[model samples]
Every structure is written in C-alpha cells, then in structure tokens.
Target: MDLTLHVWRQKGPQDKGKLETYPAKNVSPDMSFLEMLDEVNDGLIKSGKDPIAFDHDCREGICGMCSQVINGRPHGKQEKTTVCQLHMRQYNDGDEIFIEPWRAKAFPIQKDLIVDRSSLDVIMQAGGYTSCHTGGVDDANAMLIPKPTADYAMDAAECIGCGACIAACPNSSAMLFTSAKVAQLAALPQGKPEARKRVLAMTQAILDEGFGNCTNHYECEAACPKGISVKFIAKLNREYLKTMIPTSTDA
Candidate 1:
C-alpha cells in the first residue's frame, strides 16, 4: 500500500513546527505503524535528508513511548491499541494520514512527535507508591484480600501512563491517569495506610503540573489503550472527599 503522510516536524522546543508531506511507498499491510515510519526514515537517510523524529521503544506496545495522534485520534482509530501496535492494514492505499504528537500544556513538544512527558513522572512521584514499612515479606495469602477488591486494583494497575487520556480529553485533564494510579493503590490493603495522603498529593500535583480539570467528558476512557475506566475517576473523587472529613483521631 502507498500512503501520503503529513507529519509534524519541529526542530526544537522553541522552533515552530509544521506538517510536512511524504509518500510512503509499497507499505506492507502486516507492517506496524512504527515499522512503516522506520522504512520512510530509512529512505530519507538514503537520500541525505533528516529522518522523521518519533518516540518508540519495545515495539510490542508495553512502553507507551510510541505516542502519536493518527489523523485526529490518539493511537489511531483502533480501540485499546497503541500506535506501535497499530498495523498499516487498518489504513488503505492512497490514504492521507495526519500524524502529530500528544498536545497538552504539561506535555510541551520536545521535537516532532516526541513530547516531554516528565510532568507525568512528577505526578507519579508526588504520591503514587506505598512508603510504609511492612516489616518483612509475608505469605502471599497472609493479607486475605477479597477477590473483588483485588480485581479492582488489578484493573487500575493496567494503566500504562501513555497520556492518551490527556490527549483525548477536551480539558486535557490528567484525572484518568492520576485516578488510575490512586485507585490502584487505594484498592489494596498495602495502599490503605496512605490513601488520604496519596489522593491529596497526586491530585494537587496534577494542577501544579498545569494539567486541566476533569469535567466528566469521558474522552479519557475512550482513548486509553489499556481500557482504563472512568469509574476510577469516581473512585478518586470519593477518596479525595474522605480526606476532607474529620475523624475522632483527628480531633
């Protein structure tokens, strides 16, 4: 298949970027989207031109580094699929594809399709882990966690932090991602001790990092490659509210 690609090109953070058109010739339907880009880049290098810049690692799609907005959709039109996992067969020959980086104030464009996603790291650092001492490792069944609770935690843990939620949100909110992180820990016994602190800190970090607020558009859930649910956002809200209530210990 042959396709025309209009890809964003930016030299640096300060440089104004624009879309540059290039022809992708003889692309195989079996080729992944990133692989197709690699072929195009190889061709460019052979012609003494700078290759297109994009982020990709572990082409198997676990890394979430292969972040790209295909046409107008993050990770293309495929549901729950990352760009690296997206195959060329999904597109037809003679298609005009628009490729761009994730757009969010917190995630400023570094160059071309790569954006600085360190803001996400900052959010995670705020309170994404359990710091309490557990004394020593215990038996796997020692905690006796309910099956439903374990399932909920596992669901939230599936978030790969791809920032697709932010990209798809009208407000560019990080609520989905932040909520998933918060919910994952909050659901488990190990996370209960820091639930209040975790929820407060992470949500505050979201605002501090310049991420927008969630207005419940549900676009984040739609864009998440891992199929992270918006229900986590509700769980986050509940956790946050609990922090505001006064307990006898507080008194």
Candidate 2:
C-alpha cells in the first residue's frame, strides 16, 4: 500500500512549521504507524534530507510517548488506541494522511511533532501523589475497601498523561487529565489525608500552565487513548467544592 503523508516539519520551537508531503511506498498492512515512519526516515537519511522528528518511546501504547494528531484527530479516531498502536491496515492505499503535533499554549512545539510536555510534569509535581509511608504491602483483610470504590480508583488510574485530552479540547483544557489524577487518589482510602491539598495544588498548577478552562465539551474524553471518562472531571469539581466548604473536622 502507498500513502501520501502531509507531515508538519519545524526546526525548533520558534521556527514556523508547514505540512511537507512525502510518499510512503510499499507500506505493509501489519506495520505499526511508527514503523512506517521509520521506513520514511530511512529513505530521507539515504537521500541526505533531514528526517521527520517525532516523539516515540515504548511504541506499545502504555508510555503515551507517541503524541501526534493524525488527520486532525488526536490518535486517528480509533477508540482507546494510541498512535503507536495504530496500524497501517486501518487506512487504504492511495490515501492522504495529515499529521501534526499537539497544539496548545501549554504544549508548545519543540520540533516537528515533538512538544514540550514538561508542563504536565510540573503539574504532577504540584500534588499528584500520596506521600504517606505505605511500607510493605498490607494483607487483603488488613484494610477492607469496597470493591466498587477500588474499581473506580483503578479506572481513574488508567490515565497515562498523554496530553491528548488537552489537544482535543477546543479550549485546550487539561481538566480531564488533572481530574484523572485527582479522582484516582480521591476514591482510595490512602489518599484521604491529603485530598484537599492535592486538589487545590493541582488546580492552581493547571491555571498557571496557561491551559484553558473546561466547559463540558467532553472532547477530552473522546480523545483519551485510555478511554478515561469525563466523570472524573465531575469528581474533581466535587472535590474542589468540598475544599471550599467547612467540615466538622476543620478547625
């Protein structure tokens, strides 16, 4: 199969980028999207032309390092699939594929399809963890947690911090990503101690990063590679509201 790839090429963050067209010949149906790109890069290198720069580590979908917008969709419109997991068979021969990087003020383009997602790392540092001493694994009967609550926590924990949610949102909101971090811990017993602090710090960090606010568009949920739901956003809101209200335990 053959494909015409319209890929964004930029030398640096300050450099202007445009879609450069290249023909991908003899593409195998079984080749992963990144593998096809490797073939293209090899051809470019042999021709003494600059290769396309895109981010990819552990092309297994778990790392979420493959961040590119394919034909205007975050991960090519495949439900619960990352670009690394996207196969060539999903497209037809003689198709034109437009690929670009994540567009957002918070995720400025570094070069080609690679963006500086370290802003997300800063937000995570703000308070995405429970610092309590969880020394050694406890037995099943030691801390009895309801199965439903544990399931919810596990579902929220599926987020891989891919930034696809922000890329998909019209407003460039990071609420879904932030809320996933918040909801994952809020649903668990170990996370209750620093619940208010975690929510407050994370919410502030997102605003500081210049990400837009969420207004119920739900695009974040649609673009998430892990299929993390927008319900976590609601959970985050409730958590924030609780922080604002005084409780019996509050001094």
Winning model by TM-score: 1
lDDT, model 1, position 46: 100
Worst 10 residues of 2 by lDDT: 131-140
- If candidate 1 were superposed on the true structure by all CA atoms, what would the RMSD be? 1.0
**Tens-place lDDT digits, model 1, residues 1-251:** 99999999999999999999999999999999999999999999999998999998888878879889998899999999999999998999999999999999999999999999999999999999998656887778878999999999999999988899999999999999999999999999899988999999999999999999999999999889999999999999999999999878789
* lDDT, candidate 2, 1-251, per-residue tens: 99999999999999998999999999999999999999999999999999999999989999988999999999886889999999999989999999999999999999999999998998899989888665887676888889999999999999999999999999998999999999999999888989999999999999999999999999999899999999999999999999998878887
Candidate 1 clashes: the total is: 0
Off-target runs (Cα >4 Å) in candidate 1 are 134-136
- In the predicted model 2, the residue pairs found to clash are none
Count of backbone collisions within predicted model 2 = 0
The residue-level lDDT of candidate 2 at 30 comes to: 98
C-alpha local distance difference test of each model: 0.94, 0.94
Give each model a TM-score: 0.98, 0.96
lDDT of 2: 0.94
